[model samples]
Target: MIQATELRLGNYVNLNDGSEHDKIRQISGIEHKIVYTLIKGCRFAQVHQSFDRIYPIPLTEEIIIKCGFERSEYNDYRHPILFGTLTLYEGVAELHISDMYSVWVNNLHQLQNLYFALTGEELEVKI
Candidate 1:
């Protein structure tokens, strides 16, 4: 479950709807601690969801690639801002800068927050 307070307008998260795979949605709004997601409709409609059905996506190598980072020589995912490595040991994502300053993140939103804090920009992500 994700806290509405921790999410931003553009954060990507998975919304469970009893399907085999959770549906990824970009946050559109938050009110009364309830998250509103943009869903498919004419021009995309907004739907309010409970925290119980909303979850933070686990950070992974594939997700890193999806966010436009390329693989570095060290096999870590690299973008203009930093390089990241996700360990198989519990979906932990470690992002390190050129000076080797590292920050560990458990989900994609946390990574997004960290990136925005450092770069003052939102990630150009598709999902």
Candidate 2:
């Protein structure tokens, strides 16, 4: 199975007006469709059940080194925003990352960095 950690933040291609500014809210099990929430509210959310499409963003080598995977420790939970993704379920939706292999490592690292950068915290996931 493809792991979610292999996906990078940049890998997400927003089908909404061809932008990558949206964040994933949930994923669906039956269809494996990814649900995203826009950083800026859009009227489309009211009319569409799912966005046009979701695509993967590529990861870079520098990101991999910076966002290396480490096992989660109990203390990590104290910082919810840092590791919120691990605990929360995206409601009825499930999160989806592309199955592509070329950018997996780089993407994972970038994703880690993005999370830390945005929340001002680090993530500790099993390597």
Candidate 3:
């Protein structure tokens, strides 16, 4: 199950019980209450607030075909992205350092620091 907080505008989910008609709804935000429009049939729509009640619908090829999503619309050139990589080294975990290609970390403190630098969110590390 995917949490509501993790949902993005393009994510699909099942907003109702797992019935045949309840399986493929896209997360259209217009309804504000977490609305989901059906990927099949006449575009049936449903809304719910209890995100826990929803199950994220996986985007299988069949579902994509059913949804009529043109492959060209999902092209990388149409939606450019900037990305980075982070790596961790277990021994002598002390300092955090970075170069143009990657970030290297030696310990838990360094790991948390790198995570914060990249995501702007404090990461809770668990041993």
Candidate 4:
């Protein structure tokens, strides 16, 4: 279960529909501790779901690559705009902004929040 308060618009989360299969969805909106998601399919559908259905997508090598960041590469594109080196150490994601500044991100939403906090822009996530 994921706390709705910890998430923001555009964060990715897994929608647990009580099936073994997990549906990854991007958060479209959040209000009053309720998370709203746009379900993707043959047609775009908006669904207001209970917080119990929302789960944090674990930070992984595949997730980082899906975000357009290259593996084992220092991504410093547009310097002051958005630049960080993402590395997984012992199965944990470490985002190194510089030699001295770094943060441990455990979930997709947490990474989104951190990126937004630093760049003042929504991180484009490829689902």
Using Cα atoms with residue i matched to residue i, what is each candidate's TM-score against the true structure?
0.84, 0.25, 0.33, 0.83
Clashes of each: 0, 9, 2, 0
Residue 23 in model 3: lDDT: 54
lDDT of 3 by residue, 1-127 (tens): 5544555454445656645665545555534344454444445454544555566443233332332222332321110111332221223221223243544333233433444566666443211
Model 3 worst lDDT window (10 residues):
73-82
Cα miss at 25, model 1 (Å)?
0.5
In order, what lDDT does every prediction score? 0.77, 0.33, 0.40, 0.78
Q: Report the C-alpha lDDT of model 2 over 1-127, residue by residue, as the tens digit.
A: 2234433332333334345564332222212343433333443342122334443333332222233422244211123343332211222111122233112122333455556665766554322
Model 4 worst lDDT window (10 residues): 72-81
lDDT of 1 at 51: 84
Model 2, runs deviating above 4 Å:
1-16, 19-34, 38-52, 65-106, 109-127
lDDT of 3 at 123: 46
In candidate 4, stretches whose alpha carbon ends up further than 4 angstroms from where it belongs are 42-44, 73-81
Candidate 1 C-alpha lDDT tens digits along 27-100: 88888857888885435788788788899999877787787777765546677654444332258867765456
Which runs of model 3 end up more than 4 angstroms from their true locations? 18-21, 30-46, 64-127
Report the C-alpha lDDT of model 4 over 1-109, residue by residue, as the tens digit: 9987788878889998788998998888888757888887624677788898899999777777666666544432222345767777555677778899988988888
RMSD to the hidden true structure, all candidates: 2.5, 13.5, 13.4, 3.1
